[model samples]
Target chain A: DAGVTQSPTHLIKTRGQQVTLRCSPKSGHDTVSWYQQALGQGPQFIFQYYEEEERQRGNFPDRFSGHQFPNYSSELNVNALLLGDSALYLCASKINGGYEQYFGPGTRLTVT
Target chain B: AQSVAQPEDQVNVAEGNPLTVKCTYSVSGNPYLFWYVQYPNRGLQFLLKYITGDNLVKGSYGFEAEFNKSQTSFHLKKPSALVSDSALYFCAVPRAGSYQLTFGKGTKLSVIP
Candidate 1:
């Protein structure tokens, strides 16, 4: 069985530009969540998607948004990116009612 | 709001020695805690979780954690450390009414051979 997978292992963007990262959740999983891990810090939750709708969100600003497709894949879009937005973007997926989540390799976003 | 705290910034131990990484959490009602490990340039990997029932939860790579309700602590432990065990360790808890995990600042563990 395939685990969670993410696209574009790395990216480089400039301030005010937008970037979209993709993720394919693990097989048999339905819920997808996004997180941002800044240098020397733990990951901070961005948001979660369930049933193609946002189920929960963290303290992130409106510039960060996400979507979940019917196949349980997800996309994280960051608009007007800033240097501070440069970080590792991780995707985690779990069953609708499960507690454990499987994570992907993550996309490294570099805002230069 | 649920939260987690990993007090130590870094921990170092000799290979083959027992090791412990401390963690504490705060949550309303019952607490669902978890441990995850992250290698350099890699994503976090689930280690173990304490949902309910047993306070001692065993997980992958011979790692285990003890959940203390009175102390509100969940410290990760290993019988004998290995050089390959060196990585960043994170403690987390689920937000109320949501599965989104709130993570603590990670602790870096270095097992020296």
Candidate 2:
């Protein structure tokens, strides 16, 4: 089966600009979660989406938001981007009650 | 909430030698732990996890982890190291009452030839 997939392998945006990244979860997963991996650091939770609603969010600012469509595909939106926002955006998905989360290749976002 | 720690910033081992990447956790009850490896510029690849079954959990790429309840540790181990095994390894656990994973700072494993 095809694993999780993400769009726009790489992106570059200027400060104060907005960008959107897309993700398609694994074949049978229903819950989608987003993570940010900065240089030389581990992945940090951004937020999680289930049933088209954001269930849990990390310490990110309001500038970061997301949406999950009925088909289980999701989109991550970041507004007023800053240089610090430059990082690898990772998308992971799992079954509603499963513990293991499969990840996508991720979208690299660079705020210049 | 549960938190995990990877005390070592970097671990270097010779190829063909056994390797160990340490991880310790802090939690009140049963701990669900996971291990993931990230190659350069790539997303994490799941290795193994410890739930409530046997203490030894085997995962992908000839990797295994031993869960110790008394020590509160879940260490990743391999019988013999390989050059391709060099990567950044992270230990993670779910936050209390949620599915969000709290990842350790990560341990960089370098299997030198």
Candidate 3:
């Protein structure tokens, strides 16, 4: 089975610009979560989406938002991006209510 | 607040030697523990987890982790290290009933041939 997939493997955007990153959950998974990994650091939770609604969120600013579609795909949107927003965006998915999350390759966003 | 700490930033081991990467956690309730590995330019790959039951959990690539509730530690171990096992390892913990995980900074394992 195909695993989780993300779009736009790499991108470069200017500061203050907005960007959208997409993700397709692994086959048979329903819950989607997003994470940010800075260089040389572990991944940090951004937020989680279940049942098409955001269920839990981390300490991230309101600039980071996400949506989970009916087909279990997801999109992460960042507005007014700062240079610090540059990082690898990862999408993880698990079976309905199950805890083990399978991660995608991630989208590398570089804010210049 | 739940958190994880990987005490060592880097670990070196000779091929065929036993290796260990240490981790400790802090959480209010029972914690679910996990270990993941990441190669250069790759996403984190699940290694093993300790949710319930056995304290010693074996996972992919001949890796195992021992969970000690008394110490609130979960250390990953490999009996015979291989050069190919060199990579970055992360330790994470989730609060009871929560899927949101708190991750340690990560440990870089270098196995010399």
Per-model TM-score, in order, reads 0.98, 0.98, 0.96
Error of 1 at B55 (Å): 1.7
Task: State residue B72's C-alpha deviation in candidate 3, in Å.
Answer: 1.7
Q: Provide DockQ values for all models, in the order shown.
A: 0.81, 0.76, 0.74
Q: Encode model 2's per-residue lDDT on A47-97: one tens digit a residue.
A: 999999999999999999999999999999999999999999999999997
- Predictions in order: lDDT: 0.95, 0.95, 0.92
Query: How far is B69's C-alpha from truth in model 2 (Å)?
Result: 1.4
Tens-digit lDDT string for candidate 1 (A1-112): 9999999999999999999999999999999999999998889999999999998888999999999999989999999999999999999999998889999989999999
Write out the backbone clash pairs for model 1.
Answer: none
In model 3 chain A, where is the ten-residue run with the lowest total lDDT?
A94-103
Candidate 2 ranges with C-alpha deviation above 4 Å: none
Best-fitting candidate, measured by DockQ? 1
lDDT of 2 by residue, B3-106 (tens): 99999999999999999999999987889999999988778899998888999999999999999998999999999999999999999999998877999999
In model 1, the fraction of reference contacts reproduced equals 0.69
For candidate 2, give the DockQ.
Answer: 0.76
lDDT of 3 by residue, A1-112 (tens): 9999999999999999999999999898999999999988999999999899999998899999999999989999999999999999989999866668888989999999
